[model samples]
Target: MNPDIVRWSYAAASGALLALAFPPYSVWPAAVLAPALLLRAMRRAETPQQAGDLGALAGFLFAALSMPWLRFVFGPFAAGLWAFFALGPALFGVLLKRLQGRGDWLWVAAAGVLWAGMEAARAHLPGLACPWLSLGYAFAPAGPLLQAASVIGLYGLSAAAVAGGAALALAAEGKRIPAGALAIVAGLAWGLGERRLELKPQGRPVSVALVQDESYDVERLAAMTPRDAELVVWPEYQAGVPGGMVDRYREHLAGLTSGRKGVLVVGAATVDEQAPFENFAWVLGSDGALLGRHDKQHPIPFMEGRLKGHSDPRPVATPLGPVGVQICYDLDFEDGSRRLASRGARILAVPNLDPASWGPLQHSQHSGMAPLRAVETGLWVAKAASSGDSMLIDPRGRVTARLGFAGRGVARGTALLSDGGLTPYVAWGWLVVPLSLLALAAAVADALFGALRERAFLVYPPSPLGVEAES
Candidate 1:
């Protein structure tokens, strides 16, 4: 809370601002938050030890704030995550201080490698592995920029971003070196890869209709009104609430269809009487009949046993071709999108809802990322956000149209932005292992063997030779 220590708090705010790129709100500009943190860390040392601690503080705040939603799973949520992010980064920052010196570029190099490795660590931490934004998101809107992910995977972009962030900090204080050069090369590679992918194009588009209904009313929609929906869609937890309360919304769903032959995809809190509560999407036929249903695969980390396996993406046979479903958080992961496209999905449908957390920047960020999914899959993805940005995207990561921010009860057309087949990214998964391994190796080496480097003297200065002068 002190003014001097307030810089750490500044780091936390920067992290939250960067997080606007994720769900509920999709503002990507929030990413500029990182550079501020990098700037703070690149400075004269009060003590090599203290400087390292500061760097660690910056890293932890960045990770923790960016992942505040994680508190929902741990229970008694809110503010508890501060300790985790605040105290956590101290360790790595301590290590970073050992590398700082005049004309030293390794300080930033180590920072980027360590940061990327840290992100990879959180991503693989089993119960905590949520790839909220693996750095690849920065280039999501630049369609050709992420084409390199097809071969190297998301971690490549993560390493590149880390290196870029760290190198920029050092370059501002000093000059360029391997770190800056590597970052430039990585950026160029993405451009080249994107250009190569551009040569191949899918044929045709599919017509789609997404329902942004608000009938759930903090309770079960089925139990609330005249049951009648041959085809309709709802948001996460909108159809059922307070447990075992879905019977109420059946009539509301039925009414949306009115006996017309159409697809009804509902995002609701689903209960099957005898089964455990689930956040599910119940797909209906042209006449209010059940066709196929898919549960969300990647529920928010920690919000499991309830929303667990609720956001899995899968394709269902439809007249417009096999339509795919990628619920709210599902689109955040590249695998879900790749899997659906691999399975012949030409029209992707994401039935997502975000009411409590809403902002203009947030919707724009989500819309920006949505097209990356579309272009990668070479299919049309209608991201229907009940309270956020509902958008239509084509195969080239281009948005045809989008619904505004938190537009309650607003319905609009996205025309038919569709295409066929799949991109190389869809054909490959976990292909980024090699790059991840390299980054991990660099991190481990620095952590264990950095004491032998010349920069160590800056952190732990050598004793001065003293000689007594004769009187």
Candidate 2:
């Protein structure tokens, strides 16, 4: 059998396994196996270029398989998106090939760091920061491992996941001692996370109501909202009212909170002659007074046309407490939620708009990020989607209440405000981005230096007179 065929088969299988690790299928063990296979294939590659090609192949397959819903959003252009994102894994392969041969344990550690660094870079790539299907997200549904996010953040989880993969690859190659050590460390982390889950949130319990419907009808949503609840959340763009209609709807929306100590968080498109349209969440106090408006930050690239909101996100003071507001796409990233949590936000009210046309797969995947955010920031997330999957996630990443996909109704539940201090992630997890960038730069520099040194040797052979080769 040809060695190249076997290596490529490993790459292909890795991609398929990685896709299965994400939402909808969510085979957790596949997450560990996928990278193990990819690492094995890369180890067999004759050159860095071949290793990168294999990585690209696996990444492309993972993207195509895991995120087919992108086709509905981007038509045939979805292929370009997949190819673009695949570069992350390709670079990881190149770095791994260059950074190997240090030691088995060192190589495994580098693989993990390189994988996480690439993901961090992918999440912040200029206008194309799409952090979907990240390796860490594979554990979002796993109760025990999911708690680790509260301490290390998502990128740390990603590093640990790939490290486990690299260790598995080593074990397959007869390096059992180090592989067993890595497995023990992973088990310890999981055990710690499991124990951490037992810590209960100590804070005031508030009744929250999530009003969800396919039709972004203000009347219908208002009718469905529970007045008895202290906080009522509506989905994103629930009212696409222009400037003229804002005043009328403001009065009507205020009526929902009238005669009760309730706050209404409604998603609306603010359009007027003075400025471009914005995806805005309006917070209405019980007395019909406007509290604070949070414009959707981190708008979806290519798809969203609204002007990007530049103001820093903070919690909106309400009768219930300081409630943070975030639009649909904002929850996908960590910055907004972290900032809000740091600013003493007890509860986060998210207004999402995942339409049914996007498919249930998209809805499930998109909604999974909420739990990650909840765990990372120690905030109770009340996400109300227009089409479905409205949920109330506790600080520990537990889904206390949920309305499944394609269903339209109100999800009522009690959310405990975050009373404990900021989790470790909220305090220092942002360092992951900079640390990743620094590590990536160092790896690239090391690779370039090595290439240049090798080229110098090739350009000028070793001197016969005991003289070193000239530069």
Candidate 3:
């Protein structure tokens, strides 16, 4: 086969592998192999610019396939979003190729760190950022591996994956000894993770009921009675009251939880005649008193329209321990969840409202991320999606019970709720911050070296006729 054709084929293969590693297909091992294949494709490039172009092509392909659901939400703008985010992976390829050119084992580790930093940068962009599909997310299916997240967070796992891929690529190029050493280190890491998984979680059992309905109808609560529910949750935006109907809405909610001993966390679109509309989770106490509110903190970037997000999160005190309430998409980020946990929230009551328009593929993908939030905060997550995929997840990233995407149903289960304390992830969130700085330094160094190398080969004062120099 032609060398150019082989290089392009490898790039395309890398994209396909990465796409399959994410939800729907979720082939975990493919995530690691995709990075290795990308490294191989970059090795065929003669210059950093060439490596970047190939890397960008691979990234574009990966994003285009993996995020097809973006089309459902953003329509034609999805392609532009993909193009923008693909730049991160393209830059990663440029740096990895330049550093690995030295053939030093140390650079291999650096390459991995660089890749992880790239993922963090893509996720942290101010207004327009979607950090889904990180390399660490692929390992979510492996129970023991996710235990590391409680200590190092998700980006740490991404770094390890990138490093492992680099080691595998090196081994394929005949650098066997170093690759074997990395394998041993990885095995030990996994063993340590298993030990963490085996440790019993310290908490008391709390019976929680998750209600998933198309909308918050009076009949839905009137017809059903929970046997033993310490807390009852409804999906996000299920109760949208008119600007003049706050009093009536409160009266209805009061009636809903009047006799029940459990607190009701119901999603609402609170309308005020004086101010802008706010998305909130109204916390109604057992006696039908309004306990407080947890407003939606992280709404979908473009889809949210004009709805605003709250910056600080406060937990609502309840009989089942302090309960933290967040809406859909907030579970996808670490800040709101971490804040809720830090402020003494033992169980997270998530009211998700994934519209049927988003499709089953999006539902499955969204559900996969809930467990990671549980593991990161050491808080048992009770997620109720209106369309489907209502679930109960423990602190160990275990899905104790789940309802798939299709019809509306109630998910009733007992959750072990811990006394609120900061997990390692929340207490030490600075691990990735420094790693990003190191990656930035590496990229600057590679650019300098590449530029100097090109300068050395430049032909100045081209021919005897005072022609322009060849770059």
Candidate 4:
């Protein structure tokens, strides 16, 4: 077969494999194999530019296969988003080709580091930066492997996987020792992760109810009593309760609150229509009083048109403990949740409303990530989604109870409440991103220096033994 044809085949296969690694399929091993295939294909590219082109093609294929849900969610604009995602992989290929050109000994390590750095950069790229499609997410189902996330966070797992894959690739290319060493490293990491799996639940217990109501009806609250739960949370933007309409819902909320002892967290669009509508998670007191409100700090871009995101995220005081609230996409970013956790938030209540059209694929993807937050902040996560996969995740990132998608019901569970101490991740998640950036800068500089040094050596070669003696 032609080398180009073979390379293209590998690229396409890798893309497909990566798509399968995510939700709906959740074939976790494919995540590692995907990058390994890509690395193998790029090894044949003669130039960095050619490698980048192949990467772009692979990325496009990956996006089209994996993220078909984006079209249903973002409409025609999904094309632009798909292209944006493809750019990261294209750059991934370019960096690999450039770094590999320098030498083989460090090429695999460099590629893995670059892969992680690219993922970090993509995550910080403002509106388009999606943390959902990250390579680490593929391992979310593997309980033992996910333990690595507690120390290095999600991006680090990606780096480790890519490194392992690259090592195996090198072995396939006739180097066996390095591959065996990398395998040992991977096994040790997994062993460490497994050790942490026996994490003891150490915190105050609190009962919570995650209500996934399609109608966002206040009437649903009639059944929830003080004995049922300490807090009841609804999914985000369940319905638009415009300004004039808010009074009626308030009346119903007041009735539900009277003589009760639990907090009712309602999600509704407090719409002004003329001004920017606020998507609020209103905390109604047990005695029919409005205690506090946490406006969604982060709204999904483009999908959430004209709704500006706010910066103030404080823990809401409840009968159980200080609870942190994140509305859907807010969980994607760490700032809001970390801030709340820092300020003594023991439990996290996330009100998510995923589209029914997106199906289990998107639901699984969204739900799988909540555990990372739980582990990162050492807080229990209670997520209520309007269209399924609602779950209660323990502090150790275990799913205790869950409701499947396309269902309408309340998921009742107990969440352990911490007194708010920073986990190592919360203290250090800020550092990983900067370090990744520096690593990327260092890689580029090294490549440039190597190229320059090669040119200098070519221009100023040492004289042959006899010629040097004459000189």
Best by TM-score: 2
lDDT of 2 by residue, 353-417 (tens): 99999999999898878899999998899999988799999988988889988998999999887
What is the TM-score (0 to 1) of candidate 1?
Answer: 0.69
C-alpha lDDT of all candidate models, in order: 0.57, 0.87, 0.79, 0.79
Task: Give me the displacement of residue 169 in model 4, in angstroms.
Answer: 1.5
**289-327 in candidate 3: lDDT tens per residue?**
888888888767776656777889989887666889889
What lDDT score is found at residue 5 in candidate 2?
100
The alpha-carbon lDDT assigned to residue 346 of candidate 2 equals 89
lDDT of 2: 0.87
Compared with the true structure, what per-residue lDDT tens digits does model 1 show for residues 1-471? 464556555555545555554444545434434644543543544554665556555545655555554444344553555444444246445555555563355655556555555555655555655554555566665456556554444555555555566666666555657546865776687678667656644454334444454455533433322223222344555656335444445555666545454576767665464667576677666655666667877766655545556434668876545667777877776677788888877667788866535445445545556665665566667776766576766655666656667665433333343454456667765454445546556655775676456558787776554333321
| Candidate number with the higher TM-score (3 or 4) | 3
On lDDT, the leading prediction is: 2
Positional deviation of residue 35's Cα in model 2 after best superposition, in angstroms: 0.6
At residue 252, what lDDT does model 1 achieve? 54
**Candidate 4 Cα misplacement greater than 4 A, ranges:** 101-105, 221-227, 239-241, 244-252, 441-471
Better of 2 and 4 by lDDT: 2
Q: Name the regions of candidate 1 deviating beyond 4 angstroms.
A: 1-52, 60-77, 82-114, 124-126, 140-154, 170-202, 217-234, 241-259, 271-274, 301-305, 310-313, 357-369, 409-421, 433-471
Task: Tell me the RMSD of model 4 versus the true structure.
Answer: 3.7
